[model samples]
Target chain A: MASRLRSTYVLPLLKQRMEMCTEAPYLKLKHAFKDRCVWEGTVEPSGLSERYVVRITYRLGYDPQVRVLNPPLVRRADRPIPHFNGDGTLCLYPVDSGEWTAADSIAYTIVPWISDWLFHYEVWMATGVWHGDEPKPT
Target chain B: MLHVVLLWPTISGMFLIMCAATIRTGMGEDAMASQPTTEVSLDLILRGICERLQISQTQHDLAEERYHAVGKWLDAEEVPRLLKTQVYAQGSFRIGTTVKPVQRNEYDLDLVCEFNLQKDTIENPVILLNLIEARLRQNALYADKLERKNRCIRIIYANEFHLDILPACPDPQTGPECVVVPDREAREWKASNPKGYAAWFLSRDTRPSVFGLARVEPLPDQETVDEKGILKRVVQLLKRWRDLRYCKDPDNAPISIVLTTLAAQHFVYQNSEAAALTAVLDGVLASIPPFGRLVVRNPMNGKEDLSERWDDAAVYSAFVSGVRNLHTQWHALVQRKGIPNITAALEALFGEQPTRVVAEEIGQRIQRARSSGVLGVQKQTGTLTVATAPAATITPVRPHTFHGK
Candidate 1:
């Protein structure tokens, strides 16, 4: 009976927009009531800069996955794309590093991280230096 | 150039003032320098464009060397006709607002070759011009490089720069410093005052004079951020925009003197180059006559109209339309928010190659700041900051590596 009641209870839809999302009018949140919520928006790291479409997906007790949706990420000649996974998702920070956690708001942490990632990504493209701090994978 | 060397101490002093201002405002110094823009600061990218536009120290030295050689050769005692001739740089080079030509690598340097002879002795203005041409032809080096223009002798230095030496004599009726230059097409003596004009410009300029550098120092490989004052930078930016608009059809382009005069006349010192440029643009637009011809009188000599060339209806129309287009594009640039958008807008205003080079430089600077853990982000907007001392509204980003799978 308790399991049946839990199944019947409908999750509440997010009534108010996230404050950060509101500040960046270009970004929007979707599937707010679902287990997995996705936020997608355009991020221009600098003034008079390239527009990048970044999508971040998050669920309870799981790490947020960030990817650049538009202007497909590609390697420059004789250079590998830095700070990225083989599947093309950005490895923004080490999941085990405790630098970011599920408790942190996606609006506050993940969104800005994506912007920073793109910023460094462009810098790497211009000069073949990965400026983002990262630990060597074991 | 010695101008850059003498200005170094002044530049350093100004930078110290900037640092103090940053501290008093309780902002991080590194952050202030790293990020391109703030509420009242010139964008780094814009500043970068000006830096790249300026001639390098080596180039300046080369131009100085070439001009000095010509001056010495003309002033030599061996030349009876050219004795005591004085050679000095005029135009944008003298004023320190030279912008490299868009179409070529060569910079056009205007020089005044003032003869000791009296202007009254010369019956025809063309005679004085011919006399200088004959004197230059004595040397095989100058003879080979020399190209005759109507009023001046141009000595081209191949890929580097070209010097346009205008022959003139002291005006007896006016001040000794003023002179009467030849008007080739008109076959008359045109009253002009280059030295007086430079003095007037310097007096109006807020920065210390770039003249009389007794002590010379080697310029640093890296250009300092606080090198140019608001007025000079604005002039360079205007000239660059003009070049972009008129490179293909240069005959109709407005003269540099006209643009320089307008900018200097209407300049109200603003903290940032961008702000000062906008204000100057507004002043220029307002100063244009609504119903009649635009008259730009030389400040030193009111009798001389700097915009005399604009008497041609086609030239006047082209200049007016070009200025209007510049004003429109500048407004649109101000409205833009991100780096990509701003770069594209600047490219449209300036040129594509220079704008891209600056954008790349700025990107590297931001990346270095990020590596040093000086990066921060505003909570509301995703705008990045290189501020080490972030305020309450900012969240300082942590250092983390991007370990690829």
Candidate 2:
């Protein structure tokens, strides 16, 4: 059902990737690629829905970007790292460098990216240092 | 005369042996002779440790804010206006002995939502529970967050904290003051008086302040610090030890109320926090029989037994053994006279984080004192001493005296 809504190019790659990942059951793609493609999922192991809502919106345009929805992620005093924008969208990578492109699968790329961000965020909260490989915004 | 002379040496020899034993145990002149050079006395350190164990002011404020929010949310036009509702906090938060949760980032607040309604009108326990649930659902904020449990409605705030709101109706048999809360699992109403229990605990805190120190002033807009005696501090310290020791399996670990009730029962007002703690630990350890069952009852209400949770013998034994180990370590701390020994003992009891914080704070104080020239070091022994001005450069000649008369 979710595959019917997604782009033909994106859906096959997602299906191939979902078979390998354990987190596929918790994730769902809704209203894919027409008006706005929405990814709804649960971030597990932490398992708290309020703290880490996995609802994300992807809009297809000249410059494609992903926006976080549901729970707004705010910077905490303890973390003090700039990983998110004033808008709820995560500044996952440098957009100017074309890190994410339309050819990439949203499920394979964006979903895993969000999970990695959350994992690093928790580590940052505890240790006050981000150990992730992503380049932080100056 | 000859017999008396022979016995005098023996008596003198016994006295010498007693004195030697006292010094060896570090309980006599040797213990008192070496005074601390640093401004950080044991009392100050103990106070610092207690401060570390206490729940932060932010946590207290957030809990209060949430509780008040719930009360406000309940008083809506959709809810029935026939009964007056009131909220009261119970358990450690009420008693002023709440320790930081060892494993979790959140605190657990136990609250009761008492409604001024006669039992005749709301006859069934299920009806009372359903009524409260219905009212909570009316507010959009609580609709998704509410969880109906065996005894209370748990509102989980995800990462922040959860409030266990136990609904109650005024008990007819116990007059207007007492209330009966539902035991949903049993499908019956159980009698509990949180206010009365709290009052009894407060009354039992009759120990005089050992340090005669002013209460630690709370920050602006923070909750007022409760009047703390040595008993309260000991209770708090023991609770912290329990938390750290049983963090992995906190459910099977001894509950706070049981520990509090037992310690309060055995507590004797002492002149120092250390003494009070040692005495209470000794009291609790002594009361637990090695072979038989342990029964700790609530002092306020005879009907309620606090030790009901200690059902598993192995868990109870582990608790008893853990407390005994702490007592031995505490004794080692008392006898030893150094920062390292004290810190190690504290680390063993509380864990690494709090002990490290306290050690750092003391180090800072010593550093400040040293930089100001208030602290001096003896060059020969490298021992710390209070700084003093040098004697006058010119020595004055004095007359010699001969012993006479």
Candidate 3:
């Protein structure tokens, strides 16, 4: 079994990586304690005019959570926003697919996923279709 | 400061691990990460809308097949006087600015059938018009399709386009390409030069040298989408705007010829279609003469007034108001910033269905790029771009389907 990455090892790496990203300068670590950390930032996806404020919460052992803090996501007349959890956090990737492991960096994975999610969300609003990748049925 | 000094060796060890992590990500096949932002321009969206507006290849082929058949039938020597008559296309059909009808499928095509007789050879203008109508009536198919108008013999082809055939005699005095056609209302032969006008428009529609070699005129109805010049696209967009605005009051609407002429005249070479359209709009608004003043003259025959119909005070005012509305809406469209706002503005100007269809198509293309693993995000903006070459600072997003409840 692969050993879980320590929070001490993960947190500093996350901060360093986020600092290196010149594009997402607004994203900053707001709170860090024990094995949990939270980040807040704003992103405007290319081609979309709306700016969305995003909040990310991550604990060492739990799945990372991302939520749109501003411009509350609205459901279409015919359907709800696709790939969203019951609690309203985005389902950025398949949990069982091993696409995202605990070893992955939140700055590199979760922060960018938020932008990709919002991009598709706008596309969904226009087309009423979820254009993002969906997992295959077993 | 004391802690930093004490942990320096251990911190350096972790730094090496972080470097290893970075290298691992760099070498990994699926470094799906952030992407640079793709620059979406107004030119891209407008071109996409025009792509949908252009007539399909199947429709073009059918229009051509039918056009040739009619030309052959008219020239089959069915009428003795029309032995040397030539049938040819005119208007948007020839100039490649034809816009598909918003609510209907039937395109209005203009054709001129020039008889061998000179202007002096025909005693009356009615005689030439009657001869052409009679010859078409001889054929059972054409007789059923024929719908007589004041100036032209109309032949309906059901759901397809109907041809308006104007019978004329060569006007050698004006020019070789000029012809004198019968006007039933005026009881006179009006000197017109459709052939020359088309040639003139083509010359004006010439591709700029920057776009490389001059475009060879395609066969009638076969104009490809990419080959359309910025001026032609400007004309098409204007025509579509006119059609949607005048859906209920088509009779009072300014004709396509006036719009085409204005666009071609004021057309400054522009690399961006949006800029070209803006320039044309500004030029047209500036050139709209006051009521009863006729400034828009045919480029080919200076005597003919293209704005003659605007002679009526009501017609002139209506056209000016309609153009003003178009000008206002177009400005509003350009001012819009976001995709939704821009799309809403486009729907307001071009109609909802076409705008939505094109926007969706553009969305699908971006989605396909994402699925291909080439999608990257700009570290600064958190926007998407194609990761043509993977850079250490900017990482490619890993491939994963969007899934969950």
| Cα RMSD (angstroms) for every candidate in the order listed | 9.7, 28.4, 8.3
> Per-residue error at A134 for model 3, in Å?
1.8
How far out, in Å, is residue B11 in model 3? 32
Q: Per-residue lDDT tens digits of candidate 2, residues B245-283?
A: 888877667888888877787777754566667788888
If you assessed candidate 2 against the hidden native complex, which CAPRI class would it receive? incorrect
Model-by-model lDDT, in order?
0.68, 0.57, 0.70
DockQ, computed on Cα atoms, for candidate 1: 0.23
Best-to-worst order by TM-score is 3, 1, 2
- Give the least accurate 10-residue stretch of model 2 chain A, judged by summed lDDT: A1-10
Worst 10 residues of 1 chain B by lDDT: B1-10
lDDT of 1 by residue, B254-315 (tens): 99989998888888865556766778888888877887778997787776688999889899
After superposing candidate 1 on the true structure, give the runs of residues whose Cα lies further than 4 Å from its correct spot: A1-61, A65-91, A94-112, A118-138, B1-42, B81-83, B172-176, B207-225, B379-382, B388-393, B402-405
Predicted candidate 2 versus true structure: per-residue lDDT over A1-138, tens digit per residue: 011223233333333233213223355665464445555655421211123446656554322344545445445565444566544456555453434444444433454455545544543443344544544345
The global Cα lDDT (0 to 1) of model 3 is 0.70
**How close is chain B to the truth by TM-score, in each candidate?**
0.83, 0.75, 0.83
